[model samples]
Target: MYKIIIVDDEPIVREGIRNRISWADHGFECVGVSENGQEALGMIAHFRPDVVMTDIYMPFMDGLELSRHVAEHYPGTKMIILTGYDDFEYAQQAVKLQVTDFILKPITSAELREVLDKLKVQMDEERGHLEHLNRLKQQLNESLPLLKERFLERMATMALNEWEIRSKMAYFQIPLSGPLFVTIATDMDEWPSEDQGTDNELYSFAVYNIIQEIMDKEPDSAVFRYKGNKVITILSGSGEEEIYTLAQERAEEIRASIKRYLSVTVSVGIGTICRELKDIRHSCRASVAALEYRLLIGSDQVVSISDLENRRSKPLYDGAESENSLISAIKTGSPEDVDRSIGRIISELQNASISIEQCYVRVLRTMLAVLQALLEIGCNETELFGKETRLLTELYSFRSLEEIEFWLKDMCGKAMIGVAETRRNISRNQISEAVQFIHHNYDDIELSVKMVSSRIFMSASYFSSLFKAHTGKTFVEYVTGYRMEKAKELLKHSSLKTYEIATKTGYQDAQYFSVLFKKCTGDTPTEYRQKMMVDGA
Candidate 1:
C-alpha cells in the first residue's frame, strides 16, 4: 500500500483530514498523524511513507521545509502542502521543492482520490519500464557466449581485413590480433555405437569448456567446436618454441581432463605455429593431418607437426622389390608365394610412420603393379580386376590397414591360382627345377649361374645361354628377380629391417639392395611401404 502521513499544527485538522477519506479506496493507508512538520519528519522517516500532507504555516519546520528536505533526501517520497492562506509566495516555493500537490486546506476526499490515482499510474509505468530493461539485460548475458564463439570462429577462418577485424573485435570485445598462432584439433578416440543418442551438443559444449579452462590460463587463446566430435583451439602468440611447448602441455592437460571428467579419451593433433593469421589455414591443415596420422599412432595420442617435422623425410619401404616378387609369384602360379609377397608388403608398410594418403599411394602402386604383371603373364584384365567396384572403386575406401592387406592378399591369391592353371609349360623339367631351386635358396648371396649349373652337371656357358633362351631373361636377371621377390616376401611378411631384407635378398650392402630395388621397381623400400599401408576411416 502507498502509506501516507498527515501533519498540521492543529491536532483536529490532522485528525479531520485523516478520517475524511477512505484511504484504502485510493490504494493508500494513513498510518500516522502529526501535530507539526517537525513531528511529521520523525513519523515520515519511521513510516517511510509514499506521500505526506503538512500545513504550510506551522510553528516549527512547516510543510514547505518538510517537502524540501524529503525532495532532497527521500525524493521518491512525494508530499502535499496543506494551508489556510491562499499564499502566492508559498505556491512559488512549493514549485521550487517539486511538491506533489499544493492544497487549500479543509481538504476534500475527491481531490485527494484523483491525486492518489495519478501517482499509482506513475508507479506502475516505472515498474514496467524497469522490467523491460531487466529482460534485455538477461537476454544479452545469455547471448554473449554464442557471440564470442562465432567471432572466434570467424577470426580463425574468415578472410576479414584489418579494419573489419578491428571493428568487429572492438564491438565484440575480442582482444585477439594474431601475428602468430598455434592450433590444436581434437577427435574423440572412441565413442560407443550404442551411445549415438548421447548428447553430442552437450558433450561438445563440455569439451569446449574444458579446453578453454586449460588454454585460457595462458591467455590469448580460445576454443570452439569445429565439427561434431572435433573441438579446435587457437592460441595467439609469438611463433616460438616455448609457445609450442606451452600448447603441448595444455593439450596433455585437456586430454587428461576430458578422460577424467567426461569418461572419454580424445586424440589431439597440434598444428604448426603459423607466423600470422593469414596463414592460419596451413596450421589448420597441419593439425588435421596430424590427427589423421593418429589413426596409425592409435588412441589417446597427441601428434604435433613438430614431432613429424624431422620424420616427414625418413626412409619408407620402397615396395618395388615387393611388387616384383608379388608379380613373379602371380606369374609363377604360386599362390603360397603370392600370399607371402602380399604379407611382405603389408609388414614393410606397417614399419613406417607415414600418413594414410601416402600409404594409399604406395598400396595403389603395388596393386596396379600386380595387375600389370598379371596382364603381362596373359591373365585377363576383366577376369582379374572384375566389374565389381569393391576392388578399384572402393580400394581407397577401405578402412583399416588389415582390411586393405587382406583384400590384396585375397585378390593376389586368386590371380595366382588363375596363373597356375593357365600357365603354359616352358622346358617342363629343367626350368621348373631351376625356378623351384631359386625360390628356396634365393637368399644365398652365393647362389649363381655357376653353382646352379654345377648342381645340374651342365657346362656354365651352355646352361647360362639355355636358361636365358628358355626363360626369356638372362641368368643373372632371373636370379636377381628371384632374390628381390624373396626380399619382398621377408619385408612384407616379417618384421625384418631393411638391412635384413637386403642380406636375405642376397645383397651384401643394404644400400645396394635399395639401389637394385629402385632400378627394378621404380621406388625405394621405405617409399614403397609409405605408399602401401594405405589409410584411415
Candidate 2:
C-alpha cells in the first residue's frame, strides 16, 4: 500500500480528515498527522511517503513552501494542497511545484478517495514501464558474448575499414587498444574422434572453454572460437617484439593447459605483428599460413610466420611450380624425384636469358627453399651444410652454371637424406613415449589410441601406424594384451572378486571383461582362479 501524511494547523481539521476516509480502501495508508507543514516535512523525511496532504495556511512553513522542498529533494513523493476559498491564489503557486492536485476547504471523503484512486493507477503504469526497460537491458547483457564472437570472426576474415572496426569494437566492449597487434590460431593436433563425427563438436567446445579461461587473464587480449574446431586470439602490446613474445608465451601456456586438463595437444600458429587496426586481417591470414607449415615442423608446438620470413623470396620468373615440386620431393619423394625436381629447376634457369645477378638470386632462392624443407623435418643447417659456414659467399664465387647446378643438386640430396633420417628418429621417439604413457594410465577406462597419440603430440592415424611398426601390434591389441596379463596376475594371486579385478584392469563392465578373459585364455576368470588355487595347493 502507498503511504501518506496529513497536515493542518487546527486539530479538528486534521483529525476529521484522518477519521473520515477508509484510506486502505483507496490503496493508501495514513501514516501520520502533523499540526503544521514543518512537522509534516520531518515525517516525510522519515517515512519517505508517497503522498503528502497539507493545509495552505499553516504557520511557519506553509503548504507551498513544503511542496517546494519536496519537489527539490523528494520529487517522487506527490503533493496535494488543501486550501480555503480565499487561498485559491496560493494553490496556483503550488501547481508550479508539481503538486498532484489541490482541494478546497471542506473536501468530501468521496472526492479525496477518487483522487487517490487515479494517482494509484498512474504510479502503476510508470512502474510497469520501468520494469520493461530493465528487462531489455538484462537481455542485451546476456547476448553480448555471442554478438562479440560473431564480430571477431568477421574481423579476422573480412576486410573492414578502421571506422567500422573501431565503432563495432566500442559497441561490443572489446579491449583491443593496440599500437601493435598479433593474431594467433590454435586447434587440436587431432580431434577426440578421428573421423570428426558427432563427438568432434563436443570436444571442440571443451577445448574452447579451456582456451577462453586462459586468455581472459591476459590484458588486451580477445579470444573466441572459430569455425567449429579452431580458436582465434588477438593480442595487443606496446612494441612488435613485445607482442610477439607475449603471444608465444600465451600459446605455450594454452598448449600445456589443454594437454594437462583435457588430455589433448593443440598446435598454435602466430602471425606477424601489424600496427594498424585494418591490418588485423593480414595478421590473421599469416597465422593460418603458419598453421599450414605444421606438416613440415611437426604438430603440438607454436609456429610463427616470422621464423620463415627470411627463407621466402619473390620468384624471379615462372619458377614457382618447380620450386614447390623441389620442396615437396625433398619432404616425401624418392631420391629420383629429388633429382628430377632439381634438374627441372636448373633447366628453367639455364633456358632463361637472364643476367648473372638474376641467376644468382634465383639459385639462392632455391637454396633457401631446400633449407626450409630440411628445417621442417627437424634438420638444422649445421647438419646439412657441415663445416661450410659461408655457403652464400662460395655460391657467389662460382664462375660457370655447371658449378651452381652441382651445388644445387648436392644440397637437395642432403635435404632428402636428412628428412628421411629425422622422420625415422621422430617416429621411434614418439612410439616409445606413447608406450610409456599407456603404461602409466592403463587403469583409466577412457584411455584410447587417440588420447595417447595426442599426449605424445602426433596425429592418431600416424601414431597408429608407427605404434604397430615399433611394437608389432595395433594400439588396441597391445593395450589389451597388457591389461589381460595384469588381470590374470590379480585373479591367480589375490582373493579379489571378479568384478573388483575387472575394475582394477580398466573394464567398467564385469561381464564383458569375463567374456574377453575367456576368449583370450580359454577359461573364465573364476575357473582360472580355481585352477591356479588347486595347482598351488
Candidate 3:
C-alpha cells in the first residue's frame, strides 16, 4: 500500500479530503496531515509517503514548492495538487513542478474518486514490474551458488585429451581469442571432519571476491571463477614477463586477502600462457601438477610452471644395465648380490641428478619389476608379505617414490636382519605363472577361472585365494580393473560406439558395461564424453 500525506492551510479542507473518500479501498494509508509545505517536507523525511496531496496556497510554503522538493529528493513519490481558485498561474506552477495530477478548487467527491482510482492503477502497474524484477533477482541468487559449485566440480574431475578440450571451448561459451592462463588455488587436505563438510558458497564467494578485487584494481583485465579456488584471469595485449610478474604480485595480495577474511591458506600455481580456452585445461593441469613441487618450495607460495626446469634432464649415472643387475640381485635374497645392486642403483640415481624423491619412485618401480621377474624365476608369493597382506595395501598412499625406495631399503635391511633365524621358505612361483596367463588371455570374452586353473594345474578354490594374496585383488577384480582401464583408453582415443567399446573391453553386454563404467567414474560413458567435449569447447 502506498502511504499518503495531506497538506493544506485550512483544517477543514484537510479533514474533508482525508475523510471524504475511502483511501483504504484505493490501496493507500493517510499517515499524516501537514499545515504547509515545510511541515509536509519534515513529515516526508520521517514518514516518506508514496503520494502527497496538498493545496497550492498555504502558510510558510506551498504545494508547488513541496512537489519540487519531492521530485529532487524522493523521486518515486507522486504529487497531486489541490486548489480552490481557477488560477492559470497556479496551474502553470504545478505543471513546472511536475505534479502528477491537477485538481481545481472546490474539489468534487466524484472527481477525487476518479483521480484516486487512476493512482491505484499506476501503483498496481509499478508493483507488477517490481515483482517481475524481484523474481529474476531471486532466480539469479539461487543459481549463482550452484553455478559456482558445478563449475568447480567440473574443473576438478574432468580429464580431457587435446581434442576433447578443443570441442569444449566451442560449447561452453568461454572466450577463446586471447592468451589464456590458468591459476590454481588449492587448499591442503586437513584433518577429517564428522560432517565431511563442504561449504561451496563460502569458498566460492571468497574466490569471487579475490578475483573481483584484482579486476577492480586492474580494470582492463578479465577474471572468471574457473573452478573452486582456481580463477582464470586473462590479460590482453601484455608481454609474458609483465603478465607473469603482475600475476605473481597479485597472487601474494590475494593470499593475504583470503587469510584476513577466511583464515585458510591458499597455494597458487600459475601456468604457462596458452592462446585458447581449449588448451587452458592443459595449463590448469600443469598448474595443479606443480603442487607436487610444493614440498621443495614452501606453502603460500606462487610457483609458476614456466619458471621450473626438470632436474632429470642431466644424466647422473653411466650404466643403466648395472643398476638393473643391482635391483635384480636384491630380489633374489642373495646378500652378496643385494649389496652390489643397492650400491649401483643409488650411484646411478645420484649421478642422474634425480631428486631423492624421484629416485625413490624409480627404485620402487625397479623393485616391483624385479619382484615380478623373481616370480617368473620361481620365487614364493607367500614369502613376500609374511603373515600380513594388509601392509601391501597401504603402499598406494606412499608420497615420494623415494618413500617407497626407503621402504624397500628398510625391507632389505629387515630381510638381512633375520637371515640367521630364517626357516626354510619356498618361493610361490605358480602365482606369477597365473598372472602371465591372465595377461595373455585377458582379452578373451569367454575366459574363466576354470580355464586358467586347469591350464596352471591348480584347483579353482586354491588358485582364487593365491591370486588375491599375491595381487591384493581377487582374480575377477584384477581382470575387470585391467579391462576397464583398457576400455577407458579406447573410449578416449577412438570414436567407438558404446557397444563396440563394451565388446572390446570383454563386456558382452553394453548396458552392463555402461553401468560398471558409471559405477567407477561417477558418470556414464556418454555423460563423461559429453563433459570432456564441453571442457574442450
Candidate 4:
C-alpha cells in the first residue's frame, strides 16, 4: 500500500478530507496530517510518503512553492493540489509544477480514487521499463568484447582500398592523417577458476584504467577497446620515433604495474607507425606477430618490427633439400645435427642483428611450412596436434622477421618428431583393439600387456611390436603413462589419499605408485597436490 500525507492550515479541512475518503479502499494510507507546507515538508523527510495532498494557500510556506521543492527533491512522490479558491492562475501554476492531480474545493471520493489508481499504473510502468533496461545492459556487457574482437579481426585481414579505408576510418572516429600505431595485449597465464571470484570485473576495469592513464601521458593520443585485454591507440601529431618510444615506455610500465597490482602476466606488441590507413593492417599484424617471440624474450616483453632483420632470399635449407635429409638425421637419430641446425639458424639471425628471443617463433613457423608441405604430399597427422589446428593456425600472426624465422624452426622440429612417430605407428586394427582394451580394463590393478594381448587374441611378443607400430608406444610404456596421468588428475581434484589414488589408477602398491609419480612430474603426489592448492587451482 502507498503512504499518503495531507497538508492544510485549517484543521476542519484536514479532518474532512481525511474522513471523507476511505484511503485504505483506494490503495493508500493517510499516514499523517500537517497544518502548513513547512510541517508537511518536515514530515516528508521522516515519513517519506509516496503521495501528498496539500492546500494552495497556507501560512509560512505555500503549496506551489512546496510542490516545486517536492518536484526537485522527491520527484518520485506524486502530488495532488487542494485549493478552495476557484482561480485559473493557481491551476496553471500547479500544472507547471507537475502536480499529478488538481482537485478544487470539496474533494470528491471519485476524483481521489482516480488519482490513486493512475499513480499505481505509473509506478508499475516505471518498474517494467527499469527491468527491460537492465536486461539490455547485461547483454551489452557480455557481447561488447566479442563484437570488438570481430571488428578488429576483420580490419586486420580484409584488404580495403585507399578511399574505402579512409571512409571507414572516418566513420569509426579514427584519425586518418597522422602517424598511427597499434598495440595488442594478451593475458598469458590462466587464473584459478574458483579463486577468481569477482576479480575478473576488477581486472578488466584495471586494464582500462591503465590504458587511459598511459594515453593521458601523451599528446593528442586516442585509445580504443580493440578486443578483450587489448587496447589500440592512434597517436596524432607525433613522429614514428616519438610514437615508438611512447608505446615502448608505456608498455613496460603497464607490464610492471600489472605484476605489482594484479599479479598477472601480460605481453604487449607494438607495431610500426604508418601514415596511411591502408598500412594500419600491417601495423596490426606486426603488433600481433611480436607476441610470438614471448617465449624467448620472456612474458611482458615489448617487441617491434625494427628489432628483427630481413629474411634471406632462400631458406637455410634450399628447395632441393628433402624432408628425408632432416628425417635421416633424426632417425640416425642424432640430436646433435638437429641442435647444430638450430644453432646455425640462431647464429645467422644474430649476425643479421636478429634477436635471439625470436628463436621459438621461428621454430613455430617452420613447423607450419613443414605441415603445409606434408599436407601437399597427402600426409595427415591431425591427431599429433591433439586433433586441432588452432596451435598451427596462429603462426601467420608473427610480426618481425626474427619472429617468423624462430617460429618456422620450432614448427619444423615439433612436426618432425610428431610426424615421424605418427608414421611409425599406422596400423588401424591393432590401435583400435588396444584402445578398447585400455578403456574397458583401465580400473584393473593386474592389467598388463600380457593380460590385454591374451584377451585380444594376439601373442605377447607380436602385440608389443604391433602396439608400438600403431600407437608410437610400447604396451608397458603406454599403460604406465596413462595410469600416471589419471593419478595426477585424482591427486589434483580429489581428496583421496595416495594409496586410494594408486588403486584408482590401477596400481596395487602405493610405494611403487609414489616412485612413478615422482619420476613423471618431478614431485610426489602429495607435493603436487600441495602446490596446486597453494596456487589456488
TM agreement with the true structure for every prediction: 0.42, 0.37, 0.42, 0.42
How many residue pairs clash in all the candidates, one count each? Answer: 22, 0, 22, 23
lDDT accuracy of residue 229 in candidate 2: 69
Off by over 4 Å in 1: 1-151, 175-179, 189-191, 194-209, 216-218, 259-265, 295-299, 324-343, 352-357, 370-537
Per-residue lDDT of model 1, residues 143-233, tens digit only: 8777766766676666666676667667877655567788888878655455577766677778877887887676577677774567888
Writing each residue's lDDT as its tens digit, candidate 3 over 227-314 gives 3445555443246666677767776777677667766656666666655544555666766665555434445566667666544456
Global lDDT of each candidate:
0.77, 0.84, 0.68, 0.69
Residue 171 in model 4: shift from native, Å? 4.2
Evaluated against the true structure, the overall lDDT of model 1 is: 0.77
Cand. 3 TM to true fold = 0.42
Residue pairs in clash, model 2: none
Q: Best to worst by lDDT, what's the order? A: 2, 1, 4, 3
